[model samples]
Target: MNLFATFEERVAQALRNLQQAGDLPGDLDISRAVVEPPRDPAHGDLATNAAMVLAKPAGTNPRALAEKIAADLASDPRIVAAEVAGPGFINLRLDPAIYRDMLRAVILLGEEYGRGTGQDTRPVNVEYVSANPTGPMHVGHGRGAVFGDALCALLAFAGHDVSREYYINDAGAQVDVLARSAFLRYREALGEEIGEIPEGLYPGDYLVGVGQQLAQTYGPGLHDHTEAEWLPVVRDAAIEAMMAMIRDDLAALDIRHDVFFSERSLMAGGTDAVAATIADLRARDLIYEGRLPRPKGAPDEDWEDREQTLFRATEFGDDVDRPLLKSDGSYTYFAADIAYHRSKFERGFPVMIDVWGADHGGYVKRMQAAVKAITRGEGALDVKLCQMVRLLRDGEQVKMSKRSGEFVTLREVVDEVGSDAVRFMMLYRKNDAPLDFDLVKVREQSKDNPVFYVQYAHARCHSVARQAAEAFPQADLSPENLATRAAASQTAIDPAELELLRRIAQYPRIVEAAAKAHEPHRIAFFVHEIASLLHQFWAKGKDSTHLRFVNQSDEESSLERLALAYAIRCVIASGLRILGVAAPDEMR
Candidate 1:
């Protein structure tokens, strides 16, 4: 049960009672009213701003309304005390039995405790990690991959039908360069002494495998063909090989996409989806032939002031109209993107989310505008931009990868520290905030590393269970029996234990909030908080004999604490699953 949501319903019922008694207006909008934990724990167990939100609409004094609401809430036995605090907030003190019941609920639900229950199953299309298929994925791409995967898991946990997608940038100029680079390697494989890799071509050794494959399949045959004849044959082979390598890199982190939509597919098969999208916009008067003014930093000679086909993006909240075609009459990248999103809308996904890199921040508004136009305002698009990750080792900047020769490959980092550390650290910070990933720090076994700490919390829970089992060999120590015993026994009187229970109860609320905000980092922060609390409680047990979890003399008290430990373990494990990190039973 969500304590906050339960209390929110109680507040709403109190407001309805006030409306019936004619003390408040019947038509007041209570949508903005919220119930949450009080900022200061000493104030109360729960707090609400119902009075502050509804006072103006009801034409009543906030304090007076708060007093009325408090009185109504105090009538329920579940709420021990409700008092008006500060200007108009209501702080509620719940009976201890409520928390005990919440703990019981956690035990009974297990790993499914915080998951949403079929409330909203809207089809959402999440497109992320659409990195170019020209090279190995770097650490920057890894950030977006983890963030997107975690966000998808968060949404799915919150009852959304999520489809993970990756848009392949295969039809671009970069892939042509990759083709030429591989062709040079193919000639070298055939004993043609091709010198240094020419400028503007990929120099990475990763493409050497593709060259070997081509040489084995059709050795010396491609050498006799014209540039035009060999270009397509080599480009297709190179793209297939690079994508295989990219998939392998992503697999190391346990990331898998449901769909890999190709940009080339939009114009292939004689459909010209980009042209069709532009025509649809033109019919709606959203497209026109217009000339754009010179860009802010463009030189006069370089700037082309000519009439072009443009989308009226400003009509839907973009800063300026966007061009649909280039000067060479080819579809612009934005046009292809618009078509891709239109396809998403056509496939019945009204809610779309795009995870992009930092450099693509400027592209968000136009793409959102295109979605609005394509769906006729029926669709919503949210773009999450992930900032770059700065790799460091012992406060020193790490060098580039020798394989890619440009940046640190995602596979290299994952191989060095393991996927759990990489995934957890990638989400330790907000997506838009810069993150410093210290190689030395994340590997440390101390509490300094969040992944280790959280995983260790799970391990510690198991250790407690093992100790409890050894102490009471014949007792029923299953989760159900322990929960029943704990529910029947006296409530925990320690302030620290109660605080941990309160944090555990907030998991469902956190999951829902993070899902709605498209911020998976909040989950990372919350699990870390739970880990810190668990570690502090364990440390406390060393000094106080009565606070120990597995008491040898009292099986009843040991069962109660074991139940609590199991609850903590379940929460941490569930959270780690969402983050694509493993919650090990032991660190080693």
Candidate 2:
């Protein structure tokens, strides 16, 4: 059960009861009120701003309204105490039985405990990791890939119908460069001397295989052709090869997109989707012909002052009107991007999310404006910009990969430390914050390594269960049996054990909040906290044998503690699964 949501409903019901009793104004708005854990755990189990939010509307002071609400809530059997603190916040101390019941629920539900039900099921389109199909994915692309994949999993767990999408950027100048580079490799593959890759071309050895494939398929027929005649054939072949390599890299990290939307397809088949989008906007008066002022710090030759077809971006919320067409009459990149997102709206997705790199921070507002303009304000676009990741070994920076000849490849890192470590460390920080990923720190088998620390907690829980089974061979250690026995036992839970239970109860709230905010790092931070608490409790057991999970002389106490450990294992495993990491049963 969602404990916070349950109390939120109870708080709202209290307000309605006051309205019926002629204490609070019936027309007062209660939607603004919220129930959440207090900033200080010492304050209470839960806190609500119901009275504070409703006071002004009811023509009363907040403190005075809080007193009335507290009195009504104190009568609840589940609430042990309801105190009004500071300026009108109502702090509620729930009965310990409430939390004990939550533990029972956790074991009963297992991994599905925190999963949402009957929430906003809107079709959400999450477009992420749209790397250009010109080369193998770099470390920066891996960061975005993991972040997007985790966010999709979080949304799905929160009960949204999410579509994972990758927008292949094949219709650009970069692919042309790739085709030219592959042609050079093709010549080399056919026994021609093409030494020292020219400037402005990809120098990666990865293209050599593409070249070999071309030679094996078309032989020397394309090598003697003109650049214009061979560019398309080579570009298509090169892009296909690059995408296959990219897919292999993504699979190394266990990320798979539901849709691979091709940007080239937007303008393909002689039907220009970009032009259609522009025309649709023109009919809506959201497009015009205008000239933009020279951008600050732009070189004189780079700044064009000619009138051009532009989108009225400022009308929707962008800083200025954006040009949709260049001087050569070709559509701009933004024009094609606008059509791509419009297609998402047309495909019945009113909620769209784009996960981009930090460099695209400035492009966010214009794209949001376009979505609003095209969807007539019915669609909402949320852009999450993930900052770059700096790879380091010990203290010094890691060198570039010889395979890609530019940056460290994603596959290289995954292959080195395993996908679990790569994925967990990638999500251990906020997407907008610059992360310094230390290669040595991630592989360490200590508390300093969060991924190891968290997974070890799961492994430790299994160890406890095995020990308990050996100590009492006749005991039924199954989840259902343990939960039933735990509920019936009269042994009092220690303070540390109760604290651990409280942390486990907060999982559902964390999942829902992280999903709503589009932040997967929150889950990483949360599971680490659970692991820390479990380790602390285990340490206390070492110091005091009475607190141990498996006590041979006290089978009843052992059964209850085993149930608690089972709950912790389930929660940590569930959280790691969402982050695309594994919760190993045993760590060597």
Question: What is each predicted model's overall lDDT from 0 to 1?
Answer: 0.91, 0.91
Which stretch of 10 consecutive residues in model 2 shows the poorest summed lDDT?
A: 295-304
Tens digit of lDDT per residue, candidate 1, span 423-497? 999999999999999999999999898999999999999999999889999989888897787678775568888
Model 2 ranges off by over 4 Å: 297-303
Error of 1 at 561 (Å): 0.5
Instruction: Please give each candidate's TM-score.
Output: 0.98, 0.98
Q: Give per-residue lDDT, candidate 1, residue 71.
A: 97
Residue pairs in candidate 1 whose N, alpha carbon or C atoms collide under 3 angstroms? none
Each model's Cα RMSD: 1.4, 1.3
